[model samples]
Structures are given as C-alpha cells and as structure tokens.
Target: MGQNISFNGTTGVNNDTERRIHIPLYFRILSVIEIPVMILTLVALCAVIKSQRSAPVFVIHLILSDFIQIICKLMITSEWIREVDAIFPILPDAFDYSLIAGLYFMACVAFERYLLVSHPIWYKSHHSLKVSCVVSVIVWFVPLIFTFSKYFDSLSVPIGCLIPYPIIILCFVGTRRGLSHAISLTSLKRKLILGRLFLVLLTYTFLIFPIVIMWFFSQIFPQFMFSSFSDVLYFFSHLMFLNPIADCLLYLFMRPDAGDLMKSVCCCCRTDTHQNSTHSRDEHSRDSRATFACCVSVQNPASHSQTACSSV
Candidate 1:
C-alpha cells in the first residue's frame, strides 16, 4: 500500500512508519549524537550564567532554544517509537516560537562576535546594556506579532515574526565578507585561522538557511502545496545543536584568548588529575618503605640508615 503523510488534512499528518521514519541516514546519525550535545548545552549555559562573559545574556536564550529542541527530539523519538495515540493532540505551539527565538539568538551571537572582533570600539561605545535590552525586546516581540496559527493544526505562516531575518543574513554575510577582506592583507597563518573561523560562521548560517527557505516557500506555495514536509523541516531545525562544536572549533582556531582560556582550563584539570595520581603513588610507596623499614628495624634492631628514614 502506498503511504501518505497526512491524516484527513485537518489537524494531524500520519507520518509513514517507513517513509518518514526511514529518516535519511545522515539525520539518524546526527540524532544519535544529541545526548552529549544536550549535556554540553546545559553545562555551557550554567558556565555562562555564573560568569559574566560577553554576550552571556544571549547564551541563556540560545541554550533555552536548544534545550527546547532537545525536548522536542526526545518527544519525537518516544512518540514515534512507542506509537502512542497514533495521533498527537492539538496543543499550544510554544515550541514553534522558541525555535524561532533560537535562530534569532544564533544570529545575535554571530553579530555579537563580529562586533567584538571587527569593531570593538563601536560595540563598546554603543552596544551597551541599555541597547541590548531594547534589542532583546525587539527580537522577542517581532515573533509574537506573527503567531497567526490559532492552534497547532491551523498553524499558518509566521509572517511578521521574520522581518529580522534579512537583517540577520546581511549581518552574517557582511561580517564574513568584511573579515575575509581584512584578514587577506594579514599574514598567511592569521588568514588560515580566520578562514577556519569564517567557515564555522558560514556553516552556522548554512544550517539556518533551510528554515529561511521554508518560510519563503510557505509564503509562495500556499499551505496545501506541501504541508507534509513540515515535520521534516522541524527536524532539520534541530541540527543547530552542531553549533556548539562549531563554536568550539572557531574558539580553538581563531580566538587566541578563548583558546588560551580553554587550554588553561584543560591543563589545570590535567595537572590536578596528574597531581592526584602522583600523590596516590607517593602514598603507596611511602607505606611500603615504612613497612620495609619497620621490618628491617625489628630484624636488625638498629641501622644507621634509620636516621635517614623520614615520612613524606
């Protein structure tokens, strides 16, 4: 029997156990790696919160969006595998907005980095806390304006929610282009480092570009044209979890300060670990030496070397 993804086209789409669930192997492979990705997100959020880092405020939002995505993925895995209800209830689409907020934060982080790197003076002079507060309000409110879908089933194009998208694309592209040109005149080693960072930023935008196209197509083709692809679109949306790895890569390669800090932390951890191991070995050796010395003292009843014996 040929399978279709829609169920009466009213509220829910019945995804094919074979087609939809077949899930391109790439996606499945990526999904398998999400556990550590989820953990990294929690740890990163906590670390950012405890310490006042540049753009730490947006880190909370980014982590939250990724967290929501992790929850959504878990739900998808469970709901699909368990085969519960065969149909999900129509619920408030809070996750929808949250995912968009995630994209917004992704752009926010990129530009934030660009500003700090390319125009530190301008960012410090103008992009202060007051401006950030206003900018955040704008980011949140724009999405709310386009919550046109009454419920999950009737979900419509989130039109007003995306006005900032072009600006985001521009900011990402412009920043990269500017950085590339500036780095070109520099030494080869610096250019290579900058090249790697640019690729990381480029990949971040690459993951985001699909959603932007989805929005454009939803507007152009009308809902009935292809609603079945929505869930797949939703899944592709979660791939931003890879951003942490990308962010870390860029940090290790491009940002010397961040790389140094990470190196220091890792070295400190290794040093502590090594010291603990060394101390344990020393303790064991000391105990053996003491036992042997005591035995010798008892047997020999007196040794000139006893004076040299000492407890560490």
Candidate 2:
C-alpha cells in the first residue's frame, strides 16, 4: 500500500534492518483510526441497505468494495503478523488495487445516481442486482491485471490515477446535468440532492488529486522520490482511506431517510424509551380521568338526586 521508508538497501537484504526503523508514527496512527472507521462504515452501510431494501444496487456494491478494502488495509498494517504476507503474496497489490477499485466503484455510483434521477424509467427497466454484482466483479478485475504483470506493477498507481480522470469527469458532468433536468423532484429536494453530490465529488477530488499529482511528477522528477517527499506522499496516500468515512458521513447528512436509518440502527434502544413514554402518558391520563369522575360525582350529588326524582 506504501513504499516502506523503513527499509534500506536492496529488497533481499532489508528484512533484518527493518527492525531498526519501525513504521512511521503517523502511518500507524492513520492505520489505527482507519480500522475502527472501516468497521463502523461497514456496519452503517449494511444497516442502511438492509432496512432500505430498495437501496440502489451500486450502494451495496460500493460497501462490499469498501469492506474488502478495509480488510486489505488492516492486513497491510498488521506488523505483528508479517508472516501473513508470506502466506498471501498478493496482499500489497491487493491492498492498492482494492483502493483503486473503490475510486472506480464510486464513479459508477455517481453514474447510477445520475441515471436514476435523470432517466428513471429506463434505469428501472434496465437495472438489475445481477448487473451491479457483475460490475463490482469487473471493477476488481482491472487491478489484478497490474497485480500479476511484472512490468506494469511499478506503473500501476500512476496509470490508475490517469485512467479514471475521464470517467470521473464524465460522471460528474452527467450527474450535474441530471440534477438540473430532474423535473420529477421538488426544487428544494433536488437542490439538496445536488448539493450532496457536489460535496461527495469535491471531497473525493480534494483527497485524491494531491497524491495523483505527486505521483505524476515523481515519475518524471526523481528528486520528488526523495525520502522526505515520500514521507509526505505516504501521508496523503493513506488519507485516501478516509474517503469511506467521509462517504458514510455524507449519507448520514444527505439521505432523506437518515433519521429512519439512525432509528433502525439504534432501534433496540429506542423501543424501550418509546414504550415507556407511551405507557406513562396513558397511565397519567387514566388517573386524571378517574380523579375528575370522582370530583364530578361528589360535586353533582344534588343534581343526581333531582334527576332520580324526575325519573320516578
């Protein structure tokens, strides 16, 4: 997932020296933060999708990709289990590729949202869970091409950076146009949805573009590959992992059913409180009525007697 700054000399002779320089503290901190964030993001995504069974298929696929990515990142950071890499030779590539796949999957999600809003009937007729599943599989496949190819492995990250520019731009533009033409939704709701999309796009670009630009230059300017510069690059590179966390927050803020999703996630806690409040209110009303009835009977005894005499 990152260039090991701790390693010195050639790959073969570097293992023993690795113990001299542990992974950077900042990298460790990012990895630790990511572990819990990834777990919570996975939980939130699953909860959201499960309760809202009609959620877009792309959402499900996106979460699945993130789940895989989190696992890979976890492995990458597992310093104690260095032997795992030996057992799983593809871990590093898998980690990088999974992260790259996420970018593509997100692009697909934007495209899906555009279609759903812009051309609902056509999207509905053509869309299937199976198609989403297939697309998810395809997104992971591209990375494996570079994973196994020796010549391409070195250039994979830079190429990944370059490859998705057009897709991302096209999807961004299409999403904007779709929102503009969305006649089915009210102005306020459409504006909110468009705003959400814009935030997601902006956050993604901000996080990803810096690393891409750095890598682009590192290819041409070997000085950009110095350890000091590499350290900075590593920091930004791992920051990409924060995208899933941002994404979950975006859903919480933007989705119309966010409150319902929260209640669903915390339904176990809400049920008792709701029931207790309703029961307490009912009991209070019943007691008040009983007290009122007793007071009325006492105060109206003379009237009751007159009514009895009239009846006789």
**Considering only N, C-alpha and C atoms within 3 Å, which residue pairs clash in candidate 1?**
none
Give the clash total for candidate 1: 0
lDDT of 2 at 116: 68
TM-score on alpha carbons, each prediction: 0.53, 0.66
The residue pairs that clash in candidate 2, if any, are none
Q: What do the candidate models score in CA lDDT, each in turn?
A: 0.52, 0.61
Q: Write the per-residue lDDT of candidate 2 for residues 88-201, one digit (tens) a residue.
A: 556656656665676776677667767767778988888776777787788778766654552444555656745665665676677678777777776555655565566557
Listed per candidate, the RMSD to the true structure in angstroms reads 12.3, 9.8
Worst lDDT window (10 residues) for model 2? 5-14
Question: What C-alpha lDDT does candidate 2 achieve relative to the native structure?
Answer: 0.61
Model 1, runs deviating above 4 Å = 1-14, 20-32, 45-55, 80-92, 117-119, 126-138, 149-165, 176-201, 222-256, 259-312
Steric overlap count per candidate: 0, 0
Best by lDDT: 2
Candidate 1's displacement at residue 88, Å, is 5.7
